[model samples]
Target chain A: MTTETTPARVTVGTGDPVLRVRDLQVSYGTPNGDVPAVDHVSFSLQPGQRLGLIGESGSGKTTMATALMRLTRPPGRIVGGEVLLGETDMLKLDEKGLREVRLRDIALVPQGAMNSLNPVMRIGNQMADAIEAHEGRAARKGMEERISAQLARVGLPPTVARRYPHELSGGMKQRAVMAISTVLNPKVIIADEPTSALDVVVQRQVMQTLGRLQEGIGSAVVLIGHDMGLIAQFADLIGVMYAGRLVEIGPVDEMLTDPRHPYTRLLIDSLPKLTAKGKLVGIPGLPPALLNLPQGCAFNPRCPYAFDRCHQDVPAVQQLAPDRRAACHLYPANPALPALPASVQMDAATPLELTGPAMEGQEEVAG
Target chain B: MSATPLLELRNVTKVFQSGVRKTPANMTVALRDASLVLPDGTATATAIAGESGSGKTTMARLLLGFIKPSEGQILYKGVDITKMDKAQRLAYRREVQPIFQDPFEVYNPFYKVDHVLTTPLRNFGLYAGEEQKRIEEALEMVGLRPKETLGRYPHQLSGGQRQRIMVARALLLRPRIIMADEPVSMVDASLRATILDELRKLVSEFGISLLYITHDLTTAYQVCDDIVVLYQGTVTEVGSVEKVIRDPQHPYTRLLVSSIPLPDRTQRWGEDDSAITEEQARRSTSGCRFAPRCARAMEECWTQIPPLFRVDPDRAASCFLRKDAPVLPSEQVGQVLKVMRPGDAGNAPAA
Candidate 1:
């Protein structure tokens, strides 16, 4: 079931990269000072590729995704960043140019499906409005058929288009939202915690629906969520974020099996296993406050491998391997510091077996 | 296990009526003939596992005396709670306390967080000279420092810290039973293990029986000793956590176990809508509540409700498939329920 609407202006060729974000920095303006929510974040998405951005609350993963679409509101400004959608610099575009780029080039499947749709409007009209806004009034002809085909692609019945948002279940509403977002066939789709509020069975169904749509449109997807297990299942590449910075980015298999960053390791270890055998230990202390971030590495206070240099100098993004990057003092890329012993490096690769009273007093070090 | 139960719910049922003019069609059955027993003289953790509309919260509220059951009795120490005297009720209130789901909503934002800990001590008249020591001890037990959490407001502390304070407040009363309703659902994944470990320690060290209610199957496996799988307020299966997870007898239990997304990368869930459709048929279904959704449902399952069939020496499931003999009438079902009591002698035929 394909929509009859013609494709909008195809700026980039099929083989080229869809989106690129270079050294993006976003800050929230507060009464005290500017809080750097996303500092020096850089990543790119190829056509039909899935990149999962994971982090705990207050980690600025949502802010980073919002900045990519140039949707960061007032008080939260894109202080420094270049969001490149194909050859176009998204940051430099005017409001009208950005509007044209939205839905035609990149679309957003918002966090809460309930709040995304207009409650007063019917589902079909809301979808038609999205199409009309992008494709103009003449494109609204035979809109019902296009809406139904898009809805059917996501496994929703055509009758759902006539119902109001409140008339549908949470899962149904989410599917409708997905259909509307992808009806325009955007090159890139950003789904922020798309299935976070759903039940387990429904969550899997929604994820499958999103996967099917992304495959159908051949759009690059940026899936942001906190569930590491869910992300590992769906995403091809995973990026771990902590306190607004990209701590580690690598292939999904490499990041899950042999994580280099201490924070990523802790996040994976914290997931409860199906079979209850050993005790799961959470990382002690809370995520650092963006307003009063600690000196040097932000994760140094909670990191178990902290040493002398970790307290003094901020770690830059260093290439750990061919396709992996980690920002940590332990993997110092420069030749200035002597390389750590092979035994110490091997210990970093293995999962830490935390026990006894060692976990206590770790929170006290975080000023 | 002791002969007397710390708490018991005998054939309890709750029906919530909606709309201005309440009719039979407007009525929603939250819980249906549900029975549970928490054994005395032991620190046991029993988890009531289910989805959103599974009536876990209703069961917790029924036990707490916040709402009375439409039918049947809730017993405390083998005595009906509704018939208790003023003095007995006060004692019962102290014995059964609740740890709510959201820590932030449980406390007021205007007051200091320590007020949650101090109010109970003051109300129970335990705020004496050693009040500070008791508060500090309770906080330490939950792995929170008194100095760090004493003067802060609800907004000042993290979600994990706020939840720990709630646990600390429960400890101050020295309660025998703690009803934690999805306590760690809102907490972060990293911090969930810490809170769960604290709840388990309370059972082991403090001899406090915990009624842990959650929709998360993984956490249920981690902390619960016994598990009760609730589907639309009906007890579909009940047994030791290991038995229920490893060898589930009921079809609903099998669906739930399979639906849990494990950390293992190899296993993937197949597309299935039977479980979801069964949940949607909850309000209108008659006979077996789970029949509409059960993959192995029979024709008789749509007309007659099934009784709890003993699947093992310790496990019981409400399913027609488990019944070897003829279906029993409602009167004979009472006899079956009596034998199914936690510490009762073996009076029924075992699987």
Candidate 2:
């Protein structure tokens, strides 16, 4: 092995975080106004930490993934934020500097693995391209071995290096993407729904492979998806996003068992359990549209625990305990989230009337 | 409650040919020797649970008469579906309704949401002077206000609303059985529970049997009474959802049940699972489809195909581990109950 490609050994969580985001904001420019997709989001990732970001369809989890890497396309602009990659501000980096820092330090495993790979390029060439772009040209034999090894690391056989993207199955294609993204041993890997299209068996296997890879390279991973069960199983810390804001962020055990935010609690309660079968409970009303949000909190209309103060002023994210933070008016005052009212809990089993004044605002946007 | 079954699939097999000419090499067995029965007068929900390419959709399409089965028969109330007369076919069409997977694609863009509700009434010639009242009642059954949901185009409604409208359309038919194909898969997470609750209400309040086909086992366990676990194109396990999910007998079913990521944090998935290559899966057609990936595979598992073994009075699993259990008769589903009872034939191996 060449000295230039030697793997670096860094102690995990002993020093500064590998990635830190401060008041990040991303907006989509429209004719009416600039619609915020990721609004004032802030978080940090220690070395080897696995953070799973989850939300509904329009909750902007995927947008957070793209904005973190500065890959937001036209019509969507990174309005303001500081994405610090070990003190290097990514937003301030020039074009060439940004490109160099992307795969070399932070890599992105995009949402759709089927369409992410270049159709015309061979699998080996794609791996070689990612490697050659970072480090100049290398010996052909060594390059081939490295490519085969990378594919094998993700559980793909050496023969996979000779095949094209179409020749692989859905699970294999996702593994190939994982292999390519981790070829450089990136400090932070932003994987967005890497296993959405896969079945349960393959999804489990893919998550296992991702876990093994992260342990091998000691890289922090930001996994973004909509499945709470999958995220709870994989992530060390869970962050809930809603309407362009980070609603809850804490350790997985604390987040699932004793979630502080009403939206987080509703989202967790909505999942059907295998151990107990009961009436399926869902959050009443739909998530508000970003363009026409409510007066205070975006989730105020759907929140079962919303009080009078929640409708008048926005609640800033407050630290409830060490390593736990939630953006809700109930926290910092109440020691814990109070039990949901019996009437509100009953409404979860029954459908809400759309004619109610609280639901009228959401109906207009939904209609 | 009745002697005859509402709907039945008897040894049905469907194969699709890919090449221009008919050949065994290019044919794909979408469904193989599947049999199920929805007894008449019972409102139980049976879930056909499987992963993608496991032939759950093929079973649904075969029941809907969208495609003909290659080998066996699909019967509706003691008569073969393909042999039904015009009047019988119309009755079948009116009694058996379908709730498609994608609610958005089922609607026409140009028509208002009222079009879906009115078409069924006009088709059955039930649109007397109470057309408005009937539509309103059906909509109210699924918990949708008739005023706001009517007169709106498909694009103007949310996914949850559109799905509720589809449920209302099915309810208007007063169907005996509704084949809901992945009804809650496309909806948002928070809305999924609401839709599932509505489906459960159909069975309790309206006395409608539901054939729920889906790849999600959690939702299936919640809403279904009995479960049929399909692997590839074959039935691996079938029983009460409670018993089957609690103690899965088939190797594939066990793998599927264990693979589901629960919301609890104390239980984490182990890294011991190893995936089989596509080549191995394709080559093991002569034997069990899961033999290549089975952790307890024996030498005989590679060549001999196991029959569905009667493991319980109401349960059956196709696996070599239950070899001592009696083979379930495949001819008639009603005969299955008579062939084995609880104490008379206490020969089934413990799960």
Candidate 3:
């Protein structure tokens, strides 16, 4: 392989991207065997930047995250392609080597953390176990003090280390989970809907903590969530998944403000706006099944801008604006691109109108 | 014809005393002197947003009368539901149905999707051949084609399909109001919009009032017309969805709106919540539930609780900053005040 295009041992956060996946495919095993879950998905993450992984249920976004964690098990396997973490290929790692990389090099805060916690374990002890498993020979000295500091970093008092999972509130437990996930200070963190089950207030707290922690440690966060709003704020760059494929990926502002893909545009416009009130319009159909994805673009059947080419060929993630890419047959490049259906870009209290008092004067620095 | 509300909670206060915790076991107050006026059977759902401890679920249970309030009353069409006997409560429940958050839990593992949808039919005495046709319509209403859905076990269907079935069951009863507590939170993302769209269709087409309780604000902002921001056992803000969201007057509401992941991060709509420290969370709390977290908190805010003040023709918020409380004259509402016990009816709860 040529040095320019081939893999090379370059320092992370400086040279090549931290992680790159090219046409990575995954699927489940049925009686018929091998149903595609992730269809030739491709995206790359830089060391200090975040890429939001989003999709509806059965979209395979979670499956992709699980694959990165190497947690994908029976009835599920990587069907194809490269999962490169630095110059070392991740998909190529054996089970044992993958384990080392999981906690020490990267970590995941699972969505099931809400219930996955062992009720009997003290919050601090559980964290200690994680630290010990990864810290290996060095875990003996200052582990307890380190654990206390980590808990405090996540907004939990050091005393929380003494309490069992059940004693803590749902939000607290999630925060504790975050603490353990980041305890190793891995280069990457994959959080799967970490705040989906939380209350609005606590959701904010957890997100702020996660955001701050990510910034402090300078780890690239793989925030997997369906809530467009959370993804909008947390993701520096976004990858909108539809039916196991990365339909769109770009800077957050570009994707949210001026969407190119029909599915991406549909997803943004479908979000309930305060001003939309009586005018809110939800997307018409469900996401296509992974086992039997629709022909051409997976989102074609549900897309308002689907043309003949969209229905015939799988749309590739093509660059639209600089640093912005979307998987659609229609765009500025394709002057003959079919026009999207007439839809309201803004609800009654459009985001444009939401300024000053509505934002509590946070608007000045908000944008 | 009078100014009576379609569904009203008049100073509703629910106190659940756990059987445990001796030495005057603390009672959990899900609601405290809460009240709201909902237009009868308005299709536009009213969103109740709050943090977990803010008691949004307790309010749902109160609205459904699943649990009785320790004090005050809940009125449906001007009739006191708090005082309703067991049989009366059952009839009231029929009119005010609930669609649970986890659609899978609503179904029996032993039965198929059809079985769960039909259970409400048999319980409500609507299990007839005509009910069969109604089932199809309800399924279609939730965007589920009956043939693809019926007979499938809860395990067989997708999360979105199961939730749709749950919505179908609620629709089957033709209930006047649907109490959905975080209904779509569990469903996968791609299908969330479809369910939300279906809920919108239910109101615009079916004219069913929806009390949508959730912690997510973007979805609420997308779907609801009016909203109430709940604090610790209290209503902090209540008014038009646009006003409360676009320009929240209450610090709590502003915090809540800002906490939400907005579609646009550049304009992430609220204050940085660093000010709401744990010490502030503990010591700053007083007359105003959010005084501890309010950046503009004043000393008087600690002395007396503010009442809900109508900020405009269609909105009301409970904050001294609004300064427009019109406490109903004791002479006017005193005669109609009610206090009732759930145990008085002695009707056995559903098995």
TM-scores of chain A in all candidate models: 0.87, 0.92, 0.86
lDDT of 3 by residue, B28-68 (tens): 66677777655542344678888777889898888886778
Model 1: how far residue A315 lies from native, Å: 1.1
| Candidate 1 backbone overlaps, count | 0
Ordered from best to worst DockQ, the candidate numbers read: 2, 1, 3
- Please give, for residues B1-351, the per-residue lDDT of candidate 1 as tens digits: 456677888889999989867788899899998888776776677889998788999999999999999998899998899999998998898889899988768989999998888888887787688988999988888877777778877777777788888988898899999999999887766677778877877787787888899988888878776788898888888767678888888888887887676655565555555344534446345678877667677777878877777677566778989898343332222222323344743321110
Share of reference contacts kept by candidate 1: 0.32
Q: Candidate 2: which stretches are off by over 4 Å?
A: A1-12, A139-141, A348-350, A353-367, B275-283, B332-351
Assess the local accuracy of residue B52 in candidate 3 as a C-alpha lDDT between 0 and 100. 73
- The candidate maximizing DockQ is 2
Return the DockQ of model 1.
0.26
Residue-level lDDT tens digits of model 2 in B20-117: 98887889988888898877765677899999989999999999898999999999998999999999999999999999988778999999999999
What is the per-residue lDDT of model 2 for residues A214-271, given as tens digits with 9 covering 90 to 100?
8889889999988899888888889999988999999888899899999999888888
Pitting candidate 1 against candidate 3, the one with the higher lDDT is: 1
User: DockQ score of candidate 3?
Assistant: 0.24
Question: Of the native A-B interface contacts, what share survives in model 3?
Answer: 0.46
DockQ of model 2, rounded to 2 decimals: 0.47
Per-prediction DockQ comes to 0.26, 0.47, 0.24
Error of 1 at A278 (Å): 1.3
